[model samples]
Target chain A: MFPGPSAKCARLGHFLFLRSLTTEATCAVTRTPTLPVKQATRPQKSDKTSISTAIVLNRAPILTRSSTPFETAYYSYQARIRRALHNPFPYDFYFKQGTLIETRFNLEERKRERLAFGPAFLSKEDVSEEKRAADIAAVEQLAQQEGEGEVLMPRTHPSDTSGDVRSLDRKGQRNLYLLLHVLENGKETWRFPLGKVEKGQFLHQAAQKDLYAECGDEMDTWVVGKAPIGVYKPRQTSAEAQQASEIVFLFKAHIMAGQVKPQGDHIEDFAWLTKEEIKMRVHSHYWDGIKDILSDH
Target chain B: MSMQVASQAARHSLTRFQRAPKITRKLRRHPKTGLPTPHVKIVTREFAPSRLEEHYHTTLKDDLMYMTYKHEIGERPPPRQIRMTFDPEDPYSKYRHNAPVGGSQFHKKPAPSSSPDNVVRLEKIQLHTMVKEAVANKSQLLSAIMQMKALTGETFQGGGHHAVEGIQIVRAKKSVGGWIRPNVPVGVKVDLKGQAMYDFLGTLVEFVLPRLRDFNGIILPPQSSSIKTPSSVSGVVSFGLPPSALVFFPQIEVNVDAYPKLAGMHIHFVTNAIGVGAQDRARALVSGFQIPFLRR
Candidate 1:
């Protein structure tokens, strides 16, 4: 049940926080008003032309939510404490070869994701900080300068709204960072694509499936590296608090080729945010734990 | 990985020629006479042909039969059969030696049919440290090597082959200005392979990595490799061990008196293997041994 007046004030505070972030999002959307989803097929301005490609991403801007300072601090502290206590080795110590049992469906699901997501671009692997920055800027520029029609695959049937149609929107896609943010019952939150580790599925494979299910057959969007970025345990709701909590595995993916479309209605909406924008928009508690990782990118 | 390549090449050559055979002779005493019999017996042994050769032979036979039948010709001679004879003193042995005795080094170890779960192993653990100060003083280098050996329980090796000094030390005072010479051998390294590697890995994964300050386990980015077609350099996860964190290792921490200076080093794990999905297979094999992969 919702708390009394204090909870309402907290909610209002949260709303204000998001509103500030939304201003940035709205500016991006407004700049490219004429750009529609269908024009995504055509090639646009060269990414090398940096001047025209300022951050004009006006896609789903945030609407501020309410939260008390105390609540925010509490959650942040809780996360920090949890991280301090987290020990990944104890559970993994009994490791034996071939002990990781994976199911066929799960394996296929992971394979499909890897096949569709494409190669990931690591911020650290390729040498030269200047070059990596230039690449990121170029991608951001391309995503911004391109007309909406130039990047989007044409919408399929008019009747298909909350189905698999969006996921099948593979077309001439350029490399862009894919961030799946959830608007769960109007509470704005950013979470990378993730799902339950199915029976017989390895942790990494499950992450791939979750990413692929959300992004569809977008090339270079799949995670290829055998490792995960981090393991996150989300706070549970009161109703589900008694149940086993879910652990999230964040993977870095790049849009090597072909665009992506959302699969089903489980997610409210998705957007591609720049690394800086992600840092700014994510919840404070989440960001505190993930800032190091995001900085690497 | 190179071993696998050599085995494949050897198999290729073995299939192209008739294999050498071995002959054995035995004499038996007469049952009633209690004396050796004059008659001699001879036996011939041949290596089992590869499955590929057998398949090739059948297909070749079918082709010859079809040609003979199609032309409606008279009796066609049997296809030439190459006889493989063993000769211990054959001079050709110099150029082409017989296959190594016993099971193949490439054979699926333990048992061919058994599941290859533990086949992937921790090949080695290499510890490296860069001591820029050692470049100026020769004694410093010796001390650094001694410290490293004390920590790793293995003899330290010499200079790393790096182009253009990867490290730079700037003199803030400007009086001592200018960068240090480039490409200097300022570091010593030790590679703990075989059993030593496993021991080091066990200690690092189970104890050191977990306790290292502000340290998260190594991350394997999914984009590093694709399962459909693995690249030779794919599936390699490399991370650095900061000097600040090295002190936490049980061996190093307890013997703090030995190390006057600390240096950082990089660790790289090459997970190359055979077959489709080799990258993932190698990763899973590593994880099964309890080394947690930090997802990033």
Candidate 2:
């Protein structure tokens, strides 16, 4: 289903996915010689010269996918929401561990699509003019530098979980932030990896620290989107007291690169998954957090 | 919208998948124990590991006979075939793989009567002894440690023996977190030296854990040697001693271990009782093998 007439409405619905480039090169690239071409820069992050007797990767660069506006919007909301939930303000009571959200804001949802591209979405509750501009500047700069990629792993809302989010939000507008990232055919679900955030650590820092700690350090992340801030209490009277009352900043990261290496004594292995898949595999609240990241952004 | 934020989160699914154990058919049993439990496994595999190359075959494949010592400690059931085994000739076939020599050995074949009586050559490692898990965990962890040191924030001395977090781990961060934890046990080694079974065992006793850890529900007191025994640190541990005194004592060592806490384990220890009291203790240890509480 696609919108009609209006330029913005012309190819509105994201239902029709033309993923591959196998068709005759009708000059999508060839015709638009003037269109911006952002090369996937291999960030020559660090030199292994000292470590290797003969460094094979002299220019070994870490290839990062170009950022998308959808992803920027998602993360923007996530950081803000997480910040709000963790502050000394009394609003912490509202933030939940599993903030169920529907796929109410995918690229196809007409209202969502409209709001997604709006300056308002990024500007919401973002009071500090300077900080907001800095954030937007990063998004715009990344957008100009965005590389080419197919929307490969597109997930649709499942029937069972479709109405669950709508039922959870008190606003009755449907908290569409619990959907998980997955392959188009529904392969992997975006589930939170097993990790712990030490005290006095930033939520995002915790995400990175825990990742390196539990999952191998090779875990690459593509910030797909962000969601509303969630106040995730591990569990009342649980042993992980430090985690018992803390905010969770959830973002949809694509395991776009690297291997799922096992590192920690507590971990067995690591995986990249979508929400529906998590429903059948992982029996944990981490799945709910992943769902929020996919949907909220 | 911050690239700094999203950039860090984006890891390739391919990278994670590639690092995952080459998944074949999902295993029904555990990678460690054949028990159908998740803690015992993360990899879904049919066999424990291909690395477990210790297989024992006799002229009669089904006549699985292990070293009387291994059976004593219950590293595995007195050798049995992959499946139930019984001679075709026996009515209703009531024997198992380790059952005495029957009319037919490997099934459909006549019982092997020509081979030497004790000619049980190592055929294939059906199930692993403790040493096997070390082999599996070490090699796998070795590669991971290397990759970890290669991470941006991770710190390490490459091939050196400096510590990582708090433990004496050799490697540090490579990436962020994901799904599936390696069910295989990982112990920090001083070098790859601890990767070896004997060395790993030394670290476990001398460092990671102390004696009198626990057996079943009881806190086992470490056995002090009235006289020195001919066993290593692991051998001393096998005696169900306290975690404090894991040093070798003058006794047949017991081989009991757990990750850190003790709820269940295989009890390996020395028994001087021979002849008259042999059958009695053998029966008792056999029963102890099943009920950890009794042995504790």
Candidate 3:
């Protein structure tokens, strides 16, 4: 084993000499150490450094293999590493596949069957879809009529008269968040404005994008907050559930710019609710770790 | 009139069939004679049998469609108790992917478990202080050590005691006075684990980062950056503290009067993510803890 930092540093000096000689003069080289570098001193053809280098060379494999990561090496060296503060307890002894989709070998066939003949067999779904569409269209027409009465609602902005903004109970006081509920198997479940984080986007960006998409016309008013309020994992249904689960990084955004209205078709409904209301609306199981976010409001 | 009478007749027949009490025992057959004969006593209800029957009939009539539908679907037997194995592809396979994996699609991790328990956790906070020898020459090494001690509230030990070499060459400039040599004892640093590390991280993330005036946010290295160091993606994205921000660190802020020379150090929050995918989840987990990350 490498003795310690002193011995390690001396060996590092020898390696640096070999590496420096090979490199072009002043190339602005960036060297990422395979093993976390504890400390390295500049090599001068000195006997003291050379002696340590010989020892390191003989035990080079041991040094690289056993080297504690410079980051955690100290902890391991000291043996002062503590059990992780959070989740100190061991995981469930038995694997419980709660709501995660029980994988069937013939998933493709089953999915195909559902796609091809499921509607025919399950005609109620088609009728429900048509009925839901009609209901949504009716709701849209009513919302349009309400939008026409924009003067009736409290307007936060008053630059010029255009009654497009929805009035709030408390003008400019946006303590409420818009929650998007998706229709799954005819049941509406509450979820945060969450979508797949795009190729170039961060989780926060995705949250912002989904917020606008789910909120529809009132999207302009909501200002996305920088810090995530909390991350929640919604209970997955058989449908819409993927092999790997995703997290809902709920951002603390407010209705900064627009009036509230349901925007997306996938969304069955949208509501502005505080943490308590969310707790009341969502399943109790999902509200487990999210108690902290509730206390925030 | 015929339709109404027919429906009435059906309801009467259904209620009568349900509400009527039936005999509980079959007649005992005589083995020798090869003819059936009553031998055993019949079981009878002690309570108001008619009332109980009426309740069932009324309830069943009210939810006939549901009851019939349930019966049509057939009773699902209780889940069989079998040896649970760790196979991901099997349906009803109890193998849970509790371990965090990389990529954006997976989010249902905590469904089978709870957060911190289910989520990728911040295992340990690592503090790295590198003092340049040139800077140390201007200021005493003792002063740098004192500053680090004051800043981290931990005694300097290991690696940091030795002078760090400049891996890359610097162009000769007036700022340095002359050409810089590679060998020199610059300063001291120490790594903190467990409680001490957590306490420091809390202060930095909650108080220090926010208090910095020009601070936008920390930039997270993309997945590609973590490709080489498969084990430590979180460690690789080290926090870069500028010289100006040195005074603001809680340790230094209170003990500003102790030493004159102040040096900047990088704090790398290392998570114990096992794989690339897990490391990605670790990154996402940390970000969700209100640690803002700038998009690169």
Candidate 3 local lDDT, A1-297, one digit each (tens): 532322333343455555544532322232236423321332112111111100000000001112223423333222211211112221121113331122221233344433323334323333466755665566556558658436554333352143322234321222344555788668777755555544434444455565555555543443222334444555555333323333454444444355546665767765555456667877777668455544221
- The true-versus-predicted C-alpha distance at residue B217 of model 1, in Å, is 1.9
In TM-score terms, candidate 2 sits at: 0.18
Question: Can you write out model 2's per-residue Cα lDDT over B1-296, one digit (the tens) per residue?
Answer: 69866654443221112232445555477568675533231211111111111111101121111111111122333334433345656666744344444432222221122223522222111101122233334554433232222111122332122432311343323332552234444433222211122222333334433343443332333444322222321111232333233322211122122112211112333332232223223333322222233322
- For candidate 2, give the docking quality class from DockQ: incorrect
lDDT of 2 by residue, A101-149 (tens): 1111111233432332333333244348885466556545554566524
Candidate 1, residue A171: the lDDT equals 16
Candidate 3 ranges beyond 4 A from true positions: A1-297, B1-118, B132-139, B154-187, B191-199, B210-226, B230-236, B254-257, B289-296
Interface RMSD of each: 34.3, 26.6, 37.4
Which is the better candidate, 2 or 3, if ranked by lDDT?
3
lDDT of 2 at B181: 36
- TM agreement with the true structure for every prediction: 0.27, 0.18, 0.32
The best candidate in terms of TM-score: 3
What lDDT would candidate 2 get against the real structure?
0.30
Per-residue error (Å), model 2, residue A246: 5.7
